[model samples]
Target: MENIGVRAKELNETIVTLRRELHAHPELEHDLPFTESVVVRELAKLGLDELKPGLGQGHGVIATLRGKKPGKVLALRADMDALPIREETGLSFASTNGNMHACGHDAHIAMLLVAAKLLADAREELAGTVRFIFQPSEETVDGALSMIASGALENPAVDEIVGLHTGNLWEGLTPGQIGWKAGPMMASTSTLTIVFEGKGGHGATPHLTVDPIVIAAETISQLQTLVAREVSPFEPAVVTIGKISGGSAHNVIAGTCELRGMIRAFNQETDAFLKRRIRATAEGVAASMRGRATVMFSGDLAAVVNDKACALKMRDIAANALGEEWVKELALPSSGAEDFAYYLAKAPGAFFYHCSTFESSEGGAECNYPHHNSKFDVNESVLWTGAAAMAAYALHWQDRN
Candidate 1:
């Protein structure tokens, strides 16, 4: 484990090259043929024990490595989907396929690949099994669930799992810093859609028509109170109305108004309470205004609660791989959501963030843009830290068991 830093340094350039290649040819969710091919080709070179391609749709790749002695199985996951954002980074390898790796999944794939190579080379010293999972459609938050349904965590049966995100989502963390939290690393996400139906009439004849717009406005206003009045002060929750559509013409009162929003919470009770309150408030407001309303919920992702022991082990592993100064405990959980939560529900695991922003002469503003932005990019020099951390964790986890 002590040599992990040196090994990561040796593979840094190759990891960066692979990351750039993936960035230039970005692909979106579940439909990554070329990206899958590149990953498969690189993994094949490592001479793994068994390579299983096209899991859960024809994009995910699962590679298994068996050690000389038997112990326990460890799973390492890396997402491989790009965002729909157009590239604005202006880098030579910037994506041109009308999509970009704005969230640094490209770097995740490269780091995991290099980690696999490092582990495969040291197979003789290994103990149990290592499962390398390259998942697709992580942006949509269904890839992990699909992979689980397809038995990505079975066969050898994963004892513990580790995943990392390469980005500057955690504020104040430099490029080499690793952010870890013991519990509730990320929030759950739920989509709430409400439709208000009312009578349509000329705008001038306000008395004859029941305006759904007014009802929608009232509903939106009341929905904000769910977090403030209903949820406990200690709990963290966010209700955001991202889209609203109602009238087509200024002079006409529309018959139907649509409201779409998202709810984020750290626990199931809070999520359920928010959903219930949203439906009741929207429907009640519409009914009182002589209008009808329908509420629909979809795309639910659970919160990522890290196992206490796993999180501590990951912190120690990261500290060993990259100096202790590079590891930092996150003060709070992030409101952002990830599909990796699905995997954690099935196995004891930990998900962490790797600060990918490095100080450059260009300026900090350009290098530290938030994820999902068109200009999002990572400092390639620190890519090895993630690889080394994952490799060290897997090797040490086997020895621990």
Candidate 2:
């Protein structure tokens, strides 16, 4: 087998080019015609065994590379939707459009494209088939479900799958490192909206009006107890009220108040319990305050759980391809959720992290920005490490065990 790390290094310029091109013209969820065209054009050059464009009832691309020998089919995935944020990175190729690839999806697509190229070049000696899944609407957390529903998993029927995420999602991980965990890499996430209805009146007449604002405040304060007191101390959970709105005037009591928040938990049972309690607490508090409350949930996704064996195989593959020092087992799971959990539900696979943080101590920018930040940027110099790891996994997974 060719040294994948060296080959990836040789293709770094191409990787950077593709990444910049995609980054400059970032697109949002559910409407990514431009993004899809870019992906299809690059993939068309591969001359693979099969290519299917426009999946997910929208813009998702699926390409396949068949090898000479028969073995288990592997799926490599990369998401292709940017956030609705304004770009502030100030790169030479920064997005002129309002959207930004703040979560590093541009680099994800570039690495997977280069990985596809590497596997396509060695198809004669490659074992089994490689399915390159360029997914859309991942920011909405429905893209994976959309593709799976539209037959992205059938035909070859992936025996296992693998994907990677980049940027500063964790601490203690330096640039170029690969972070792997055996199970439950991310928490199940859902958003809750609570609407409190009350009577409108002047602020001076506090006794006459049912103040939804007071009820909303009390609910937010009590929701914190769901994680600290209700859940086990060792279990990881988060209940955050990200947004709250009420009242039009400072001296007027509004007729209604709305609170929007996120619920994150690794345990399904715990997640369910928390949601139930959250609804109950909100309604109960509103009733106690002489107001009516309604609760709604959406943008829900399951936890990202990795197959232990698959994760270990990925660790070994990264170690062999990028050197032992580049591979590390993650100590904890992220409360942040992913749509990739949808793919894992259908197949046994692992999601790995490619650390691409920049540090001022290393003469790089002091960028501790988390994902989805407007100023978030990656250490592009070591991006080849991800391409090498994913490509090496497809080549060596069947033979590794």
Give me the candidate number with maximum TM-score: 1
Model 1 per-residue lDDT tens digits across residues 206-308: 8999999999999999999999999999999999999999999999999999999999999999999999889899989999999999999999999999999
Q: In model 2, which runs have C-alpha deviations exceeding 4 angstroms?
A: 361-365
After the best TM-score superposition of candidate 1, give how far the Cα of residue 77 lies from its true spot, in angstroms. 0.4
Whole-model Cα lDDT per candidate? Answer: 0.91, 0.91
**TM, every model:** 0.97, 0.95
Query: RMSD (Cα, Å) of candidate 2?
Result: 1.7
Error of 1 at 377 (Å): 0.7
